[model samples]
Target chain A: MKLSHKELEIQSGQFGEVRKLALEHQMQVGKFFDAQSFVEISQVHIMADTEALGLAGIEYLENLAQYPDPQKQVWVPTITDPRGSDFKSFKKIKQNKRFVDLEKRAIDAFKQLNVMMTDTCINYQVFMPPVKGEHLAFGDTGSSIYANSVLGARTNFEGGPSALAASLTGRTPMYGLHIEQNRIPNKFFNFNVRPTNFSDWGALGGIIGKQMNSYWDIPIIYGIDYKPTSDELKHFGAAMASFGSTPMFHIAGVTPEDHLAQNKNPKMNNISLSDLNNFYKSYLPKDDNLDVVVFAAPQLSLNEMRILSELLDGKKIHPKVSLLVCTPSAVKVLCDKNGISKKIENSGGIILEGVCFYNMHAREIGEANGWKRLMSNSAKIINILGGYGYETILNSMEKCVISACQGKIVK
Target chain B: MKENVYFGHIGIGEPVKGEALVADDNFSARYDLDRINGNFSRKSHKLFNQSYVNKILVLNVAKGGVATAWMFRSMKISKICPKALLLNFANPIIAQGAAHANLPLIDRFESDITKIIKSGDIIKLFPKEGKVEILNEKSTN
Candidate 1:
């Protein structure tokens, strides 16, 4: 990957080993195609959720910190899931001054990058509002799917810290779905019928993602049987992204992919009815009897917290139910600043970090504790961690919270 | 180019004739496929799919190396345990470390202890190709 002359000149200005790596990475990325053909990013946000490699992550952050453009907005989720965070790694480290200096360095980077640094993924709606067709580099799995599929924001499924790198560089390879030609699904889902409810819609997404996970292909939903609710879309996106790598999707007339409506002989698998049953059976496990419920592994958004707060306020979790709430690094601060964290704490819940139930192996805790039924509002969590003896329920954050209080699936 | 064995293409080894529980990543293994019915009920999914318990489990990257070790420690390894192997594609030096860290339980399957091999090396061993960079373990931030 040869760096163009202009790119080489820009790479010269970067400081520190981390920033230098960021430059090298971008330059190597630059060689991928026309150097000038960069993704147009007006504002940038970095969703650096917790991963196991601390030193490597710090380096990744260092690269993310050195944003070439000062105007780019940035955000980083702080330590929300202590359980999932490499605690063993934390204990083993000889605690260098560099370790203590990590948070401050992260703060400094955020300040320099003008980052909004919120740990909450659900709150993207409040902290930032990306219009349809905006290209921004963000890494929160839920936010990534939400931004691209729901909000119509465009970005690839960036991981391995590249989202942070893109935020620092303010450009991603204008390839894949970032390119318009790719947005038109190689496959089309002809749905002359729309579902009447939310779960059905999400179930539909699960079906698609499962069938296509291996293909790395996107499908345009031609006729949705019904308009899915917020909860429905959330799970649908999570399940689809989980089984398959579907970063973005189109509902025919709803999204940009509608243009392919008339393309005869569109590539598709036409999901058989049995496959739909498998999709439901795949994520929505049948055992609903449970011992506990969990929310906030990657940290809950204000909306999620709001629902939990509203549901659990006057209510008490079943005596046998042990509910745990996790918030992101940013939300922990916001929760502190606003008092939402206190509310959950007062309700006899623990506010831990691990982004989602998938974080820190909390689902393992449910299994170990003999939780027979597990419930959550996150599609990603369900899609990723749906396999325990526990019955997994896919519902809105609101319904999930209510169910937690009542000790039953609150329809 | 023909020498590399990409994923999705079936490998040439004598098939293990067992219930294969395949997941794209650790979380999916832990969450999506453990239940016999349709609900969430468990303290943890360290071991999912009772049917595959002593069968064969092919895991992808598990939270770097530490989680891989911890995951194995939690799940009991019996005589029927599936062989574990860390997937080390030939690329940057950083990823080799990841693959080594990803499957700490690889050596437990004494009969089949094949953990770290370059992507190109897989062709000599398995002879199928489709680009098996499943979890993108290398691109960790």
Candidate 2:
């Protein structure tokens, strides 16, 4: 791979050991992909939640922080994905002190590296939005999928280690979604059913993701008569990336990358409303008693928060059921100022900032709280939590709120 | 005794020998694993309940989240990781993970590796050399 003079110098340890190490890591990755050169990235969003990082990952960060020179700090603007738990709400959520200690250590190490702890996967919405054709190193799969398809930014599924490396070096290997040739549509899909709500849109994405289930296959979907809001596509892209591991996609007239599609013909498999109904019905709970109802996985946008707030107005959550709402801290601030947070909290729902449900030790918490039957409005969350021993049910945002109130599946 | 050798793209980490755990299904540390017990925990996965530790995992491709990259590092730390990975194709997340964990990962073989190798086959991976030798014939003799 080609390296600039400064990169070569860093490789030879003229720069600090941290930069040298970061460059070495990037070089090895570049070789793996046969990347010819590095692409300068504007910003980096790292997904290093404590659950994924573990002790070794934290130790690795701490070791890097031991570097004396501040030159070892991140070269470009860098932020983080959602944390494992919100420290302010950890006790309320029954998170043990051990987890909190580890979280603190990880945060301290990141602070030393001069990384902004945005703690959001929806940084495209609240933080700096990636511009068209903008190169970035974003770690979260949902974030990358959205940035590539919706925002027309260039990135791959960078992961935590790679994103951190890119942050330190201010660049990443020019492979995967970074190059234009790889972005063309490999599969075509025409939607036979128009989605009515966020869950329906998510189910549609999940269906298509399963059909074209690979990272390399970019599916260009056609025949959407209506426009989807950012929040709807947020759930759609998140579920698609979660279920399929898909990185980039195009939606005829919808997404930014749609124009680059070589094939304009929508002569692929068609997805109908019945297929979506079956997809949702496949997760229908056998019993109505709910252990928990969640509104997260991507964390709620401000619009989603407002919708949830209005849904819970004057409704008391059943004592047997717990309603959890996860949102970005910045969005949560807006929710607080606008009284959305108070309404949800007053109705017995816990609104957490900077932490999603699945990544926040879902298995341990489920076992600790005896949460066996979980209901969520998120197609992405239900797809993930099933492996963690939760009998997941998929519902619309309104149904999920109603289920929380009734302490059972409403339908 | 006959030796069957298959070449793949040059990969990371040192060459090593281990029994093959073959599956046509795709892999993801975050989506399809119970790392604590070293087993494929996702029920829908073909290798569900199978141990991945100390084995050379042969899968078709990689799927799902970027957490796999960091998960590999922690799994290595806990000594519950596959010795190496062989895939027909790999996304950047798997490549980055293998690099971080320093695990041998060779992909982009001429044919579907999952079909060529079978479970319990003794295999020697030459990552730097981009070669995978099926040593079962030699071992039986």
What clash count goes with each model?
Answer: 71, 0
Give me candidate 2's TM-score against the actual structure: 0.97
Each prediction's TM-score versus the true structure = 0.61, 0.97
Candidate 1 Cα errors over 4 Å, as ranges: A1-6, A13-17, A27-37, A52-56, A59-114, A190-199, A213-216, A225-232, A260-262, A265-278, A282-288, A296-314, A325-354, A360-373, A386-411, B1-141
Model 1 clash number: 71
Please write out the lDDT profile of model 1 over residues A76-104, one tens digit for every residue. Answer: 32211122332223222122234335544
Interface quality of candidate 1 as DockQ: 0.11
lDDT of 1 at A254: 58
Best by lDDT: 2
lDDT per residue for candidate 1 within B1-141, as digits (tens), equals 232223332221222223333333332223433322322222344333334443334433322111221122123322222333232111111121212222212211111112322221211222122122222222223
Off by over 4 Å in 2: A264-267, B1-3, B137-141
How do the residues B35-136 of candidate 2 rate in per-residue lDDT, one tens digit apiece?
888898788789989999999999988877788899898999899999999999888999999999998999989889999998899999999878999987
- Estimate the lDDT of model 2: 0.89
DockQ scores of the candidates:
0.11, 0.72
